[model samples]
Target chain A: MKSLKIFLLAGILVASCTNDPVEEQDSWPVDFDALVALNCRAIELRKARFATADSLRLDMDSIKASMNQSDFEKYQNDFETRKNALLSESNALADTIRLRMKGVMSDLGPDRKRVFNDSLQATLKREGCE
Target chain B: MKRILTLAIAALIISGCAKDDEPTVQETPTKSAAAKTYDADFMIDYFSLQCDIVRNTNGFLPTIAARGYGYLGVTAYESVVHGIPNGQSLAGQIQGMSAGSLPLPSADLKYDWALVSNKAMADMMRYMFGVNLNPDDAILIDNMEANTKAQLSAGVDADVIARSEQFGADLADAIYQVSKTDGGDESYLNPWQTPWEVPEADYCWIPTDLQLQPLSPDWMNNRSFIANIAEDTQIGAHIPYSSDPQSEFYAAAMEVYNQVNNNTPEQVTITEYWADDPFQTCTPTGHTFNILKQLLAESGATLEKTAVAFGMMGVAENDAFISCWKSKYDYMLIRPVSYIQEHIDPDFTTVIGTPPFPAFISGHSAEIGAGIKVMIDLFADAQGNYTFTDISQQQYGFTPRNFDNFYDLANECALSRFYGGIHFTMDNDKGLELGIAVGDAVVNELTWPKNIQ
Candidate 1:
């Protein structure tokens, strides 16, 4: 009975390790379409975030134009605060996208890696991300 | 009940293992019959690659690079024009090209427009820049062509694929024939040949550091993509050349001198960003092309829109340089560096090295001006703002910079030339004005198709 159990465990391991070469070449190991859908969502979010940051920058410019010398230091401090806040938000969003990118990349085999990367960049560029 | 539950869990595990053992044949995603099928992404990727090629290519003068890009741009448009139902040929509307000069796609035929564009670009880039390319770069172009062809040919009918590829190659050859006569003349084979002679004049440009001949002096006389022979292509008059301390030219030189002296960190960064330097860097036109690529991608541009964006900017920038160069040589303006060292500051060095050509109107300013004008025409808000990040130089290790709008970007590019102490304020300002005119002509004068949604 113990020998039977060991034989079953070894059989399972071999089965799990085997990957069909044709399918591996033809299709991604993970859900590629799902990843693309997730990426599109991230891009939409990023676009809005960037637009908001730009508007904030424009507002600062307006305020700076109108400010007198006495208010210059205070204006600079406020600018730094707002800028830092925007940077923090930008970093968090980028981190999320990076994680998604890594997940997608993990499934791509060596041969398909360049093609997948090229496609990903095209998608990102198309979606307005740099 | 507990024994039953244990058995059930074991059964589920066995089923999961069985599932993993199964050979699943996943199908590629389906598309509607009416949905556009061409890959616009490939066109964008290859053009960006071409920019890198042009940047890395040795002795590719600005004018020569512009001309190469112009041909590549039109080839892309012509390759896919048949696919866009509303698209019209840019021939005849452009100078030297007539209607029917290039072949049109057959109405009855089906096509993979992406393949058409891909083949056209690969062929032309190889033909135009191949001899000058190093072995590694050559491999890159070849790999892109082979990989794209393989990907696109899957599940396509053998005959249809053959016909489509043949059509792309034929169109590229026809366009290439026209390209040859535009004063380029096997320039790839002899990049530094048919050398330009610097004419003798009071202000005729002399060689600056690391420069030999005046680069592309004959480019002013090259066939323009726009502007007929009789067209008025001159800029508003430059401040007349003078060495007197009170003269306008002297004061202009002083502005450059003073700016270099008081050069802030911000000014230096802006200069480097727009400098688009490094022998491997695409000049200002490449920078603008990169922006266009990003904008089109952002808009989810169709193949037709992709072609037109490249086409318009290509025509605008190519002609702008031709017009700017004409004025550069015609004025024979001396460099600010030479003038400043002689009259104002002998020890004064420009923050960036001066280019070989005479500078009355800055090429960067003119190209950026033309580029921005077309972009504003296409995508600007009511406030005339079309914000985008420029990472065109990122591959060369420069960080991406953001702009508030097209005009703001153009203004910064103009300022960069000034901050570099290469051009006086007049060259940048008036060059901008001239570029706007050229860009306007490209948009208004040509009878091309409106962009696809």
Candidate 2:
């Protein structure tokens, strides 16, 4: 009975020791790639939103050329309100992405985190998201 | 015979549980007493984490960010100064800092300087950002400190690790006490300084955005690291505020108007790249620090060299903002958008949104000008040339920009503000001048280590 107990304990230790690498290999890449994709999507969304804001600004400028001072001021107030809302929404989205990235990255050790960041930057650049 | 079999089974269990990658506790021969023997990975990691924290934290605008960088750099240098050959403490050199301002490590004891720096940085970050630090950022900081200690603690004596950590924490506490008197403590709590009385004189700055009031109007009152640094490097008088179409002031406004209206795509790209907007990119100071980090990494700088460089740049950045802010509110010059819209073309709009502040001197220009000077001193040759591609903005979705020389890079940064139509020529030019002066003082006036081994 004692011999069996020793054999069981040794088996458990060996199994525990060998399980980590397999778990890491299975999960790390999938999670890292998902994070990279999420970040890229965030960047694209920010770009599109900003582009929309820029177009709106141009429209306001064109409209301003023909309007009287009082009318333009009123138009300007409304335009600012809309522009601010769009920017705020975009900013909030970026903040959320940052928080998510941090959460994903926190699980990694420093060296692994560096690798993940380097990969993310490369992926973003290759995809022309940067 | 049965007892021997039981002992053999125990050994098998222990051997199976041992990690193959775990380092043995034997002392490493290469880890000498010299600070330069160690790589700068620990400092680099901490500063990289700082960039994210600065970006995420609320109200860490350029001026406030510069202050945090100043204390961080000073703390880092102090944490490891004892290990550097011929290294001098920044205490007596910088203003309001006396000699023996920080705890000293015992001469007889060995220490891991990187571990010391790790602990100091961890403490400083918590103190610098205080309650504003995000929970996510706090986790990153804790992880970085733990990972660094784990890596550095291997092969080091337990006594040395404990002593080094205590000294680092003590150094941070002492530096924090010093920082409390710098007129910027808790400035982040009230960044806008609401209820400010805007000057009503002609050409005085007007609010371009309703959301932002004049930022840190009394930031000029913040104590500089170098005594009289701001007062001595004051910018000359700007062109007299004139509304006439042909006057120099009018010409400056026209120049901004023309540049924005006719800006090439490349110019617009430059404008956006250097925007260094808060909440998106960490402020301008963060951008400059990132460049320093990149350059140090490329150069493979030692822990000692990295600490000194960060300290010098930090002082220059902090003083540059104070000096620039002083000139800013002193002149209270109108931004180009306001000037062009009111005087040149009623429908004029800038390519970028104007920052809400007095615009005599471009804060971006002044801070970058100061930073580039320090980089040139450290990294450049006789002609101030250091070729490198800046990928610091890549994380912000901007493409990397290349520079063949530091001077051109500084010039481009200053010019980007002009191209953005937020700053006039005078603002960029004088801001650069002021920044260079501050940078020169940090390089020449402070007594850094003459020989870093």
Best by TM-score: 2
Can you give the TM-score per candidate against the true fold? Answer: 0.71, 0.77
Model 1: per-residue Cα lDDT over A1-82, one tens digit each: 9999999999999997784322332355555555555555544444443444444333544666788867967866665576
What is the DockQ score of candidate 2, to 2 decimals? 0.04
Q: What is the TM-score of model 1 when looking only at chain B? A: 0.88
DockQ of each: 0.01, 0.04
lDDT of 2 by residue, B1-453 (tens): 999999999999999997643221222223347778888877976877787788778888878989999899888888777777667788777776776556667665677888889999999999999989888888988898999999999999998899889978988999999899989997888888777888887799988754447899999998999999889999788999999988989998998989999999999888888886423567889889988987777677899889988888889999999999999989899888988889889888887677889889989989988998889888888567877767566545455576778989999999999998989999999999999999989999887775553
The per-model lDDT (C-alpha) reads: 0.70, 0.80
Residue B444 lDDT in candidate 1: 80
For candidate 1, the per-residue lDDT at B236 reads 65
Q: In candidate 1, what are the lDDT values of residues B1-453, reduced to their tens digit?
A: 999999999999988886322321211112211114465777877777777677557656677787777788888777766665555676666665766677655545666677777788889887778468767778888899888889878887787677778878888888888877888755655443446566776565666653556667667777887756214656767998888899888898899999988999889768867876533346777778877886776567767678877888878878888888888877778888878877787778777778878888899988888888888877886455855555444333234466667788889999998998989999999988888888878878775566454
